[model samples]
Target chain A: MESKPISLMILDIVSILLLAVSTYLALVFAPLEAAMGAVQRVFYFHVATAWVGMLGFIAAGITGIVYLATKDLKWDIIEVAAVEISLVFFLITIVLGSIWARPVWNTWWTWDPRLTTAAIIELYYLAYFMLRQGIEEPGRRANFGAVYALLGAPTIPLTFMAIRLFRTIHPVVVGSESAEAQGGFNMTADMRTAFFFALFAFTVIFIDLLWNRIRLGNLQQKLEQLKLNILE
Target chain B: MSAQREKDQKPSAGFLNSVLAVARKDLAAELRSPELLLAMLVFALLAIFIFNFALDLEPALRSRVTSGVLWTTFAFSGTLGLNRSMAVEKENGCLDGLLLAPVDRAAIYFGKAISNLLFLLLLEVVVIPVYSLLYGINLFNPGLLLVVLLGSVGYIAVGTLLSGMAVQARTRDVLLPILQFPIILPMLIASIKASDGFLTGVGLEDAVPWIILLIIYDVIFLAIALMVFDYVVEE
Candidate 1:
């Protein structure tokens, strides 16, 4: 692995600081959502992490395209990094959403399009890793991984659209006389500020994590090559 | 001279012949042993039984559960046939032989996909009769059968491609289903909705959109898998 540049190291620290400030802003500066109490506080981190999760998925897809075109191992490494970070962030988002949902909706899970799509996307990448782990040849692994990643990308959006279309056509009548009742909430200006800033903060955090993860990937590859050379 | 000729003109029936030969070979092999088709059939029946016992509802209540049960059976048993079909080819070293043939990779993909779809459809055809008998619900709706065909086509399209890649991995046996189920969710959902609509006496107007979505998904992924198969099989 290459030596850590001073700028990346500084960026790492800045991300941590920003995350802390963002949490504080979410916890303190932002007012609690009136209808939902303390649980609403989880929304800031939830959306932030989900934002990064999405960013990671899109990044991995783009890197998959680039890797296929260039036939480069470096892009494969970047793809893995983006996928791993996104997987963890999406897990956090799901958990936080579940926790928040418990109090608000009285259910741990819902068939909402985005949540279901997130779960499916998470599974898609899990399959991605499993696919990578099975191949013994590095070149074949890189090629197969790139191909699978590219193939999996289209299904994610289609899955999202299918669910949305299904829901829209058949509205769920959940104990409501008024038609305006199925899980829709209006956001105040203050809530919007906190929400958007959390997204911004998480974007920074995602870049930092992606950088570290890619560096770790590089280190692992170098060590493997070194081991091969020493054996020879 | 051969390289120049090859570049200038396609390989006529040689390529298509190899593809058809491979497909015919697989079909004949399965016909003799019948292990792949039988296993998928038994698995689909077992799944329907499990769903029946698991739900433990009256016959009157079974209509609502029929679509879900039918699709689940198809999905699970389809995965079985897919994994076994590819695993057999890999174990016998035939996959490598197929790759060595003078055929376009897309031809191999289509050939495998068609055979896999055949296996799935065979199982589904039998499962419907067994399910209707067991649950005492009618399963002969034309629209429902249409959904079955379209859904299985989409499922097998992606499944055959992924199973090809999965069979090459170290975790070959267990990896196919893990890789397939998540990616196939859209097809599953669309199929279920369309099938449910038909089974419950809903209009074709209600089901056309989901069918359109299925057609779009099948076309897009078929193109993607076709394009990517070369990469997957490349040395």
Candidate 2:
């Protein structure tokens, strides 16, 4: 058995530590929001998770392209890892989003632009995983996955823009829009600290998870090679 | 290596000629059978009827809902045509033959896309008139037709590419829509909005943004599809 690299072990510990600090800051240090009260705390994790999901999504797309260009199984490993991680993080983001929404929007979900786009992307990547599953040949699987991810690059952005062309009610957390009017809240000093900390913590955690997933992918590839060798 | 040598030795065909040749090949084959088109046409008509009844769209509400109904029908029927179109290639060894030819992969993609676009246009031509006659709506507006053209271009651009991938899968039949609908959602939204605008007499100005969106999507996806199509069809 291959040992986990020292850097990865370090990353694992650091990620846990950062996550602990970020949670403390978000749940306790952060001032309670004025309007939405306790429910509003969900925003800190929601945005951070969505950000991590976005990172993994883009990473998968890029690695997909790189896989095609180089025809390297290594890139394929990275691509799948990115995709799997992205899928889980995106699901969390959606659930966290719904938890935040149920109280504020008075419904579990709304068909607003961002909300709609987010949900559609979740489904889209789910299909991506399915597409990869239907093929047994590793090379063909990699090729298709890469192509699909590349396709997502334009499709996802276009989906967002297309929905925006209709209308948007998803609150702009950072912009000048009155948060009270839109059921969003601008951050105070402590909240800002928490928000930024959460973002940093999640970024570290994302990297940790991604590295672990990629290691698993590499091991799976090796196992497949071993099985092939036995068959031969 | 020998194939590359053979490709280089042959007289060069114009890029457009190869693209047209591929599209013509698909057209000729489809015309000979005519079943795919007939099926799409029938399926579209059925969707329109089903929606008309299902939505309980009375005469007063018909105009408002017409564009939605038409696009939904097109989307569903378009799926059928796209699946059949690519699945045929995979079945008859046509895709391999096409790949062996010295044509650029983009030409094949464009050719298939163009033929798919034509099939959709043909379906629209027949469906729109039937829909108009059935509903007593004057559906022959220039703006709406323009939107349809642009929308179909964007849609077929993505569909042909995804369907190419889907047809290779074991679950090819079900995979196309799953892989396609989300990606195609934007084009569908813009097309429906633009069509609705034109049908409602909102003036070209109001529909202009959607039309632009359609064109932009068409251009962007076509470029992306063209670039990645080689990867899709590779051994």
Candidate 3:
């Protein structure tokens, strides 16, 4: 395998540094939420991770469409990288949301639409991997993966809307105070700064990880092709 | 120009005929064997029985739980029917023969989907009465029946498309539900809600949105499956 590029090395360093800064901003710079106390602090990272997850999901969907149109294996690699990153980020978002919900909602979990949709989206991602694993031929595997990703992509928005329409106790912090009854709070300037910065930091980390993953996928493909050639 | 127009019109007409031809093939084959419907009905009965024992299904509880229990039975057995429907095509090499026929691929999709819908409806026809007889809840209401039909259309639309893809994979049987369940969650939610409304005699205004959502899901997925069926079945 080729060594990591110098630019990626720089990005790796920058991502770690920004993560540290964002953690400090979240942990110290933001005021302790009056209503929920320390547990509320998890919201910064929670929303940030969810933001990255959404970004990765959209990327996967677009790449899936492009792969279908162009029939290129490269787009498939990028789609998988995007999905893998989103899967990890969404996991963090769900766990953090659950932790923050415990003290505030007086329950470990709520059937809030957002949480439920997140859980469902996680299942879609898992099923994506399982579908890919079951296909032995690389080209067919990529084709099936892209098609499945495309079909599965719309569920995220529809799920969000369905849950929103059904009934939602999840806090809609960024918008109007609709969820005030459900422990939604207004963000002060400091909290906003931390919140937005966490979003920025996570976006950077997401790009950094996505680049590394794509490179990894390329390497794996190359290794497979090499093995085939040697056997022939 | 006249000859070209005739050629174009011929294929469009052929598409519908081809779709029906495929559906008829599946229906005739299934009638001869009768195994798919038999399995689905038995499985639906078992699922209802399990729910009966598990939920205690008292008279008061039966009304509230009927929609959920019925939809769950349909969803589980629906997968069985879908997997079997596609697996039969694969096992008998019918898929390759269908593909080699000079028909629009979407015709094959519609054909399989319609046959799958018929099998599921057949299972529901048998299961619903059994459920009612055992629980003593009259489930013959017109509105509830409409809800069941709409819900099954949405389920079979997506289930047919996904099962077409799943049956091509190595882990064919196990992959369908995993690929299907999360995507079909909205349909299940809407179906259960709409069925509950109809069974409880709620106002049409109250149930309209869920019914509308079900219709929208059915249309959207049917369009998507038609457009993408070519990619999935292509060599």
> What interface RMSD do all candidates show, one decimal each?
0.9, 0.9, 1.0
Instruction: Report the alpha-carbon TM-score of model 1 versus the true structure.
Output: 0.92
Model-by-model DockQ, in order:
0.79, 0.86, 0.73
Q: Write the per-residue lDDT of candidate 1 for residues B35-138, one digit (tens) a residue.
A: 99999988888787788789885777787778888898899989899999999988988888887665677678878887888889889889898888877788
> Could you give the candidate ranking by lDDT, starting with the highest?
3, 2, 1
Q: What would the DockQ be for model 3? A: 0.73
Off by over 4 Å in 1: A166-188, B1-15
Question: Clashes in model 2: which pairs?
Answer: none
C-alpha RMSD for every candidate: 3.6, 1.9, 2.6
Minimal lDDT window, size 10, model 2 chain A: A175-184
* Per-residue error (Å), model 1, residue B131: 2.5
lDDT for position B58 in model 2: 86
Q: Write the per-residue lDDT of candidate 3 for residues B1-235, one digit (tens) a residue.
A: 2223433645677878888999999899889999999999889999998998899988989999999999999999999999999999999898999887767777889999988998999888898899889999899988888989998998998899899889999999999999999888888888888899888887587789889888888888888887777888888
- For candidate 2, the C-alpha RMSD (Å) to the true structure equals 1.9
Q: What is the C-alpha local distance difference test score of each model?
A: 0.83, 0.89, 0.89
Query: Order of all candidates by TM-score, from best down to worst?
Result: 3, 2, 1
Pick the winner on DockQ between candidates 1 and 3: 1
